[model samples]
Target chain A: MASRMRIRAKAADGVTEVKALMSHPMETGQRKDAEGNPIPAHYITEVTALHNDKVVLQAYWGAAVSQNPFLHFRFKGGAEGDTVTIKWVDNKGESQSDDTKI
Target chain B: MNHHRRTFLKLGGAAFGAVATAALWPLRAIAAAVRPNAAFEATALDGAYKQLGGTPAESADIDLSTPDIAENGAVVPVSVTSKLPGTEAIYILIEKNPNPLAAGFMIPEGTEPFVSVRVKVAQTCNVIAVVKAGGKLYSAAKETKVTLGGCGG
Candidate 1:
């Protein structure tokens, strides 16, 4: 599958700030369809961020997160041209990863 | 001969069980470290805090920012930054949501104690940011009035 994340990492003053937007349904399982059928819960459960193959940040999310989630964070020791990767695994066990240069 | 065969079958079963556990140990550990499922399943603020294993004291050092009023409850912008030293984790909780715990971010060494995300609020409620610093829990809260509920159809 294609990358589901749009990521931007900028290095400035010895810190790399990373911002990512993930495309996800984030269904809370409480909403209903047109026929009033309940939607099953499907949301990203874990997100991991890596800087130059080293883990930097990890996030755990619930269905309360909005659809198409956005995350912003910063880490030190990352420089320009270093690799920053963002990966997420949902409750259904599906996973996606995308990387970019800082 | 029958007794010997039964003993052999029991040994084989035990060996298979050991192999399965060895194969799954790391995966289970990683899952537990990455996601605290009990905390996410909590339906109230106190329940969530209990699952997280601490009572958070209100702190001014944790800066929590949210809009005064959210026109759309489906997506309310929230951000938190902890000024306390040794800040390890940050948790976002919406008091009125069906489940109070919305998200948790682990801030490893060298990472800033700041996070930003958007969350669904069921109704007008208080958005709380709890920070774990130096093995203690600190939190700050802000109220956001939602014009529409986010969880209903």
Candidate 2:
């Protein structure tokens, strides 16, 4: 998807705090072209974050969502230096993934 | 001859018309530029709005501190403090962004509503701070300006 994504995480106070930013047009079909044509809806529909293979959080998004989504979430019991993986898939089946360790 | 005076008047009128058009150039350009669905964007907020379930926000009891104007859109400083009891969550939203949701925090009980951070705003937008406490939402907003183009993903 040629996505430009950045992830930052911190495991403190027994919580794995995660901040994620990803790139996607997230076009809602209701939008129009230069000629006033309806631009089809295209957006990342699902995103999941994992801490050492255990799913920490997952969400389902919709066209109402905006482009270049930015998300922040945290989980209990994650430790420093643990690997955190995040993945997202768009409505068109396009996908992107990345990982960062705290 | 009177015709010469009339001819001069016609030239003067043409020059005056040109100057008038030049003075109004910016307004004309803005009028032609897209005005964005300001109303729709104003009402449609971002983030998992339902996850932090609460009553629709009312503009009372939340002390939202921010600049009257944000000189930079890429990283505007934002802070939220509240008088609401047992404040549990705070969210930042940009009303003019394609998606109004900028950031959401699930502040654990006892976690303060005093949160500070930088948020990216693509254009001139309203920054909404929603504080959830005691199962209700109290909110406030400030208008921030993004002078440079930071809207790019």
Candidate 3:
């Protein structure tokens, strides 16, 4: 899907806060337009978060999820100015990654 | 600057500030807006989050409340309260949302077990709470429904 995403992250005192939002139709296969045409699947399948290249968080999702997904999570053992990066990819093979400092 | 231009600039800047703010505020507000379907969806179960260890959730007693039926799909009130000691973090998730993740809070050690926010939910689903106490993950969840639909919601 031709959509954009925004991510924000902060790490400190051995803990981190990471939030993300992705743009997509998130069309559930069950959805049908006015013409009653089935909307094919379009939604995020994987999300990953890393701290200095060390895997920290990840999840798998399905179309049952809502549109423009938003997530908030935390990390441990981090300090100020530490780099927190997040990456997300949908079933359609669209993906993006960005990072922020604590 | 002429008086009228100055007035216009002042007025325009003020107006611009309001309009610009309104435009930008909704971006986060819309993303964080909560809906009915935001309840009952499981969170952090996929081990998608960084954990203290192999144990992703610690399961302390907590209360995550949303109206079983929400009137507005745009901004639903969600609160999480934990009875666990040394509560450091409380993360909120809208289970059925496009992302199934809503707001993540980094609670200071002394923070009360409760945190509330407006989240966006696209359908009917559960909301989950993942609490961290003394460096471990614990959680609970419930279901809510969204009746009104659309961006106006």
Worst 10 residues of 1 chain A by lDDT: A1-10
DockQ, all candidates in order: 0.78, 0.04, 0.03
The sequence of per-residue lDDT tens digits that candidate 1 reaches over residues A7-102 is: 999999998999999999999888889898998999999999999888899999999999999999999888889999999999999889999999
Supply the TM-score for candidate 2. Answer: 0.49
How would you order the candidates by DockQ, starting with the best?
1, 2, 3
Cα lDDT of model 1 overall? 0.92
Error of 1 at B149 (Å): 1.8
Q: Pick the candidate with the highest TM-score.
A: 1
Task: Give candidate 2 regions above 4 Å deviation.
Answer: A2-4, A12-17, A28-36, A53-67, A72-77, A89-97, B1-125, B146-153
The per-residue C-alpha lDDT of model 1 at residue B75 equals 92
Q: Tens digits of per-residue lDDT for model 3 on A1-102?
A: 354457676655655667666666655555576797877867666666677777665444545444666666565666777787777777689887777776
| Residue pairs in collision within model 1 | none
Candidate lDDT (C-alpha), each: 0.92, 0.65, 0.61
Greater-lDDT candidate between 1 and 3:
1
- Leading candidate by lDDT: 1
Off by over 4 Å in 3: A1-4, B1-68, B72-141, B149-153
| lDDT (10s digit) by residue, model 2, range B91-153 | 666776666655554455323356555566667877888776766777788877667634332
For candidate 2, the docking band is incorrect
